[model samples]
Every structure is written in C-alpha cells, then in structure tokens.
Target: MLLELIEYHWAEDIDEVLLLLGRLDVKTVPLAGGTYLLGLHDDSIESVVDLRDLDLAYISEDARGIHIGAMTTLQQMVDSPLLKELFAGLLARAAKNSSSSRLIRNSATIGGTIATGSASQADLLTALAVLDAEVVVRSGSKTQVDLKGGSYEHPGLALAGVVYKGKHERRIPSGEVQLSRRPAELIIEVVIPRPTLAVGTALMRVSRTPADVSLLHAAALIEIDAHTYRKVHLALGGSNMEPVRLYGVEQMLEGQPVMNPLNSQKLLTILQEGMATFRPPADIRASSSYRRVSGMGLAYRALEEAMNVASWQNVMSSERGS
Candidate 1:
C-alpha cells in the first residue's frame, strides 16, 4: 500500500493554518514535521499545510517554565541545556536513543509527539506518564492537561507543546521502556519527575516477524511512602480503545509497604489479574494470551523497578540526615 504524495502548503501564520483547517475536509491533517502526518497522506488525506514558517517549532526558556514549541525538533531537545538539567529524566532519556540521525529529531515536534502520543503506543509515553505530565492545547480556547487523557484530541491545526515548570532547582528523575521490533521503529518518550515509588512501563510485543503499531502497552505512576505506598496512577495504551487508567491495579497497590515481601507478591498478582480484563482481539502478530503474558511482565517489571528506586531513595535520605 503506497501513500500518494499530497500537495504541500506552507502557512506563515497560525490564522492562515486555522483558516485552512476550517475550509478543508476533515482529512486535511496539519503537518508539523511530517513524522506522523505524512503517513496519513494516502490513507485518508490529500493535502498538508506545512507549519515550519509559523515559528511554532523551537524551544523557549523562561523562569516560569520551559516552553517547548510544538514544532521544535528532537535534536534541539537532545542538546537543550534546560532539558538536560531540569527535565533530564524525561527529555534526556527519551530523546537520547531516538536515532543516531539528527535529521529525524530535527523534524520531530513536541506538539506532534503529544498529539500523536506514539510513545505510549510505542512504549515511550510510559516515561512521561511516569512523570504525571500532559499537553497544553489551544483550539478555540486554551486548555491545560496536568494529568493524562485528551492527548489524542487532534483538534486539527492548533497551537501545541509539552510545557514544564522551570522553577524547580534539582534535576528531575524519570525512566522509560520501549517495546520495539527494531531500534527506531514507532515509539514514545516517557518522562518522570522523581523516581521514588512511581513506575512507568511501555510494553509492545512484536511477535509478527516485524510488528507495527503494537499489541498492548501500559503506563504507571505509583508513589510508595517510607513504609507504605500512597498513591498510584496507571495508564493503558494499545491495550484498550483509548488510553485508559487502570483502577484495578491502583486499588491493589496504593497502600502497600515498600519492602514487604508478601505485599509485593500480592501487588504483582493483583496487577496480572487487572490486566486480564484487557481483551485485545487477535491480530496477525499475536494471540490474546501472549499479549496478556507479555503485558503482565512489563507491568511487574515497572512496578518492581519503581519500588527499588523508592527503597534506595529512603536509604539515601536517611544517610543524608544522619
């Protein structure tokens, strides 16, 4: 299936882009870097309005927070001093392995990343999901996403970017996991603030020789206190119709001990049980049971790593205090 090349229009201003959106058919998708939108050209779209001229594709810095322009490339993030020090957990780790070719990162945009949310699909969103971050979207009106959900709204041509509070002093801690058939295949970047008790997992099992899209994925944000787990947030991608929050896993791990062996086993068992609820229809790549098994390990690994981090932090704090 070959996608036919479509007409390209470079919009100098946002007003022009929005105007074009209002006039074109729903198939007319906006192009930031052509990383994802270009794939749709032959699928259902025919025209692409280039947004490079809008100046919406650069990284902005200020005391309030870091403003990553929707069009900024991954190369910029890879070299961004601000992102390197403050948001290191998310940006540094996520974009570090994007590819050796700077060209792709040079075209990847933060807005495009959030809107497409491929990281979650590709297993990168779990890191950002680990950090409890969202997108800042502007359509008819501007909106804020302090938490996950609504990233895929894809409100046509609009203003977008992943914004971070730049006021924090210390470097934030974040981690990510990718389920890929190859190194640079479709993937997501996960971000984290602190790695105490929270876990972020993005799992994609590609058993179909070379799997595309994904079979199942999960993202988590769990907080285990000094002696007990306090709060938990789990997000599902590719495993459900939309990115879903796993309440069943949350209900089981919110108050467990960080070092208790019995509680740990119970947590793992409960997570596997909750994940069983996900009924991924059989695709050419894998069966429902295979996906379930892989997903179970992915989730458990994320939780286990998050717990170890939490336990390590506790020891560090105690040593510093003493």
Candidate 2:
C-alpha cells in the first residue's frame, strides 16, 4: 500500500506503454482505471504505466460482433444502448449487477476486471463466458485468444498466452508457452460474436445483500430453431477462482425440444447429479455444500429463463409473419 516509492509514467500510446513495461530495471504494471492496482499491496511493483492517454475506450459493433475496448468502465457498459438491445441486455445487466456502488462501477475498467482474476465478479464473468467472448491482446505481437466455450482455464490466462487463439489473428495454441514463461501482454479489447439464429440469454446470482458479492451465480445462452435447441451454453461461478461452463449439461440440452415435461425432469436430474459430483471451494462467506445447492438451483433457473425467452421470440416471429 506504500505509494511514496512508486513512480507513475503517463503513456501516450501502446508502444510507449509496452516499452515502459519491458524495462528490466524495474517491475512495472499497466494502469487503466487504477481501481485494481491501488488495492494491491505488493512491494515489488516499482512503476505504473498509465494508459488513459491511449484512447482505448469505445464501444462499437460490426458484422463480426460487438467490440468493447479494454478501458471501458462498468458504468459505461451499463449505459450502453447497444448492449441493452443485444441478447436481451445480458451484458448490460451483468455490468449493472457487478457492483452496487456507482463509484466502483465508474472507476473499474473492463480490462482490469478480467485481469484482476477476482472470483467475486462471477456474475459478470459468467455472462461473458456464456457469450463465448474473445479477448484481444497485444505485446510484441497481437493475438485473439478464444474462451473456447468457457472451457479455458481462466480469462486472465489469455493474457499469459495459455489460451488458444483462432486462425484469424496470430494463433497461439495452448501449451506453446507456459503461463510462467509468457511475456507481459496487454488486453486491447473483447469481441463477442453476434448470434446468427434466434438466441436468448439469462444471468442469475445469489448474494446476502445487493451490495455483497455473489455466493453463487449462473449464466445461460440458448439458440433455438423450429422449437428445437440448436445450441446451448451454461456457466457457473462465485465459489471458485474461475468460472466453469457446464459442458455436460449444455450437451444434454442441445438438439433437444425446448423443454417438454419429460425434458425438464431429465435436465433437472442431470444438473443435480453434476452439481453433486463437483465440489466448490469453501470460504468464510458460505460453505461448499451451500454453494453446491445454490449452483444447482441457479443453473436450472437460468436455463429455464433463457428457454422461455427463446419461446417468446418464436411467438413474436410467428405473429409478425401472419
């Protein structure tokens, strides 16, 4: 927490920021909003390269997907009209629920949120995972790391070169360089691909108070075609260091009818079974058993909500056609 010894450098561009960070004489960290860096008590950090002057704050959409700059704040995300309209406001709602304090939301940048690797931000992280977000990073070179259906180790790992990238950008296949050996990389932006088919998304969280961090949370995204599920994504977090996608449950629901009585019962049973076998970390806020039970219920409800939204979309389409 000692700030007296640390030096701050205002970086005008990405290359300058990289040069400052690559200094062998001092340990340096990039600063965006500085919300996360200010909380760290590490004495090894000798300098901070401020990126505010780099102009890395904007939100736009193209044929590929929605592009959010790394320096965009949580409040900005919540206030974005584009986000509110996309996927039924899944990203906007997640950003709004991330923190009850307006001050925190305004000061915390999206890049820092993902780079800090905090489990308490599960609600927002899970939503991003369910959307299959791709993180764009730059160091000596540029690469786009895929979250890969939320199966990647952690969002932060993308910065460490531990995650695999798609063929579009420079491909850095997983295991090419271990996390410990990777050079410092800066997150440039996050890209979320637009869904081609009718899609619904939902996010749910359990917390002691509105201001308190989540004890457990779930997020789901579903695409339907002709009353049948064409694709499904489900992610859970809050009890662990990283959010986890429920691949088993997603696979079971994909290609199935939107949820008949039999399908609902079967899905519930499978979710319960999966939750029972998986263990969450125990912490002072809640016990592992409590998190397990909450996760099971949260996941089911999130999936149900997403399915209902998809059904409503179908109904509206039919009404319009008539």
Candidate 3:
C-alpha cells in the first residue's frame, strides 16, 4: 500500500497526467490498474496520478492490424473479438494463460504488463513478440517503438497504444532481453501487424504448476511457401528478463524444408548450441540446468507445432483453390 501521507491525483487527460509527473517536489507516476503500484512499497514515492479518469481503455482493428489501449485489462484482451479472429486467436489464447487467477487478470492491464518490463515472464509478451508488435509512447508528442526490445518509464512519458503490423515481407527475428522491474512509463495501447501470408503461431510454457510462474516459455510464428519456410520468429522467456530471439536458429531454419523430421532434429542441435553460451538464472522455481533443458524442449515443440499449423493451413488453402 502507498504511504498514508501520500497524495492522490486524478487526471482527465494526457496533458494533466504529464503535468503531474513533471512536478519537482513530488515523485509521481500514472496509476492504471494499480497491480504493479500496490506491489511496490517504495518509500520514495510521494504521490500517484490516477489514469482511470483518462479514458484510455480501448481496442480497435483494421487492415493493418489491431490497436490495443494501454489500460485494457488481460481479461478484456481474452474477451476481445478482434484478437479472437486474428492470428487464430493467438492474443486471446496467451491472455488466457497469463496470471492464472481471474482476480489478477481483471486488475492487470496490458500497459502495466509491458511498462513494468517483466515481460520476460509474461505470456502476453511472448505472444506479442511472436507477432512483431509495436508500442506507441507519448511524452510531449508521440513516437513508436518496437515492442520486441522497447522499454519506457521516464517522467511524463507513457505508452499511448500498441500497433500490430499486418504480415508483410519484413522479417521479425527472435531474441530476448533482460527486463527491468522499475516502472518506466505508462503503456497506452499495443499494435499487432497482420501477416502478409498465412502464418501460424504457437505459445508453449513449462511451469512448476498450472498457476505458477513459467520456468520456460516459447512462442513461434512461421509462414511457409510450399514445403519451405518463408519466415520464422522464435521468442523465449524464463531464459531472460525479456523475451530473447533465437537469431541463429531462425537464420538456419529460414527457407528450410520441414517435410523431413531430420530438419527439426538438426534445429534442435543448433538451438542447444546457440543457448550454450548464455546462463539462465537459478532459483527455487527452477535451476539453471532444468530451465535450459526444458526450455529447449518447449522451443522445439513450439516450432514443430507452428510448422504443422502452416502445413495444415496450406493444405486447406489448396483444397479451396482446387
């Protein structure tokens, strides 16, 4: 809980929120869902600027992709018709698997999830990474940052919205970064681009329990041309604070044929080799060795599932044409 002496301020618009954050004497931040704020017992915080009255919660979609409001809750995301229709309901699926309990899902906001920088373990983040999502931030004006490796949490800065791009020729390589626990900024919304072609996405998580934190999580997005992979994106969490991309693995698999089980077997070797250099953190949830070993399994499985999905979709399309 915040200090008894702390001051509460309600903002009706972005201008008012920024003004409060710019104050010199008071340490302030915009409070969205308060899931993260309540967890913070920092004495340094003197006040909180409530964004509830700002009317930021929104979700919209178009040919380009979906636009998600920063204040949208995980539960809301799970219930979004737009998300359910696009990418075979990938965003909704990920949201369903996030933070097990309904109470937390009801309170946790997507903006808070991304802004907190704990996305390395967030199911929603893993899915977003696979989809090449981007976040819009507003300080005084507006700017867009790639969500794959973006962070915001400065005074007067907040995430305005997110953009998911429609599938195009642009290839989003997979990689992960360490996440920061400190609140950096407010996320207003998220945007996901639509794939130019038929793309298959899959999310996999390995946790100690169904409701517990993920020890290893993997997300895969694949587009195939005939028997060859036209594009591939592999993202991971539990190995780092933010989702890490499997660059070497993606490079090796690009344009490769998946008809042969041998191809996936070969990828398993490459994936293990690529991860050998990095050391995963060890804690009570899982030891370093367990995370690495299990993580590799989840990654391989995700890729395989993605390939299978692409194959099925391709077959269905051909059948329709015929």
TM-score for each predicted model, relative to the true structure: 0.63, 0.84, 0.81
lDDT of candidate 1 over 81-174, digit per residue (tens):
8666542244554554433456766776655655565432333444455456533433222334343343466433443553432111122112
Q: Count of backbone clashes for each model?
A: 13, 0, 34
In model 2, where do residues sit more than 4 Å from their true spots?
2-4, 119-122, 141-183, 260-263
As a whole number from 0 to 100, the lDDT of residue 293 in candidate 1 is: 67
Error of 1 at 167 (Å): 28
lDDT of 1: 0.52
Error of 1 at 54 (Å): 3.3
What value does the lDDT take at residue 35 in candidate 1? 71
TM-score of 1: 0.63
- RMSD to truth, every model: 12.5, 10.8, 10.6
lDDT of 3 by residue, 119-178 (tens): 325687778887888766554333455443334653444445564322111212212212
Q: How far out, in Å, is residue 248 in model 3? A: 1.1
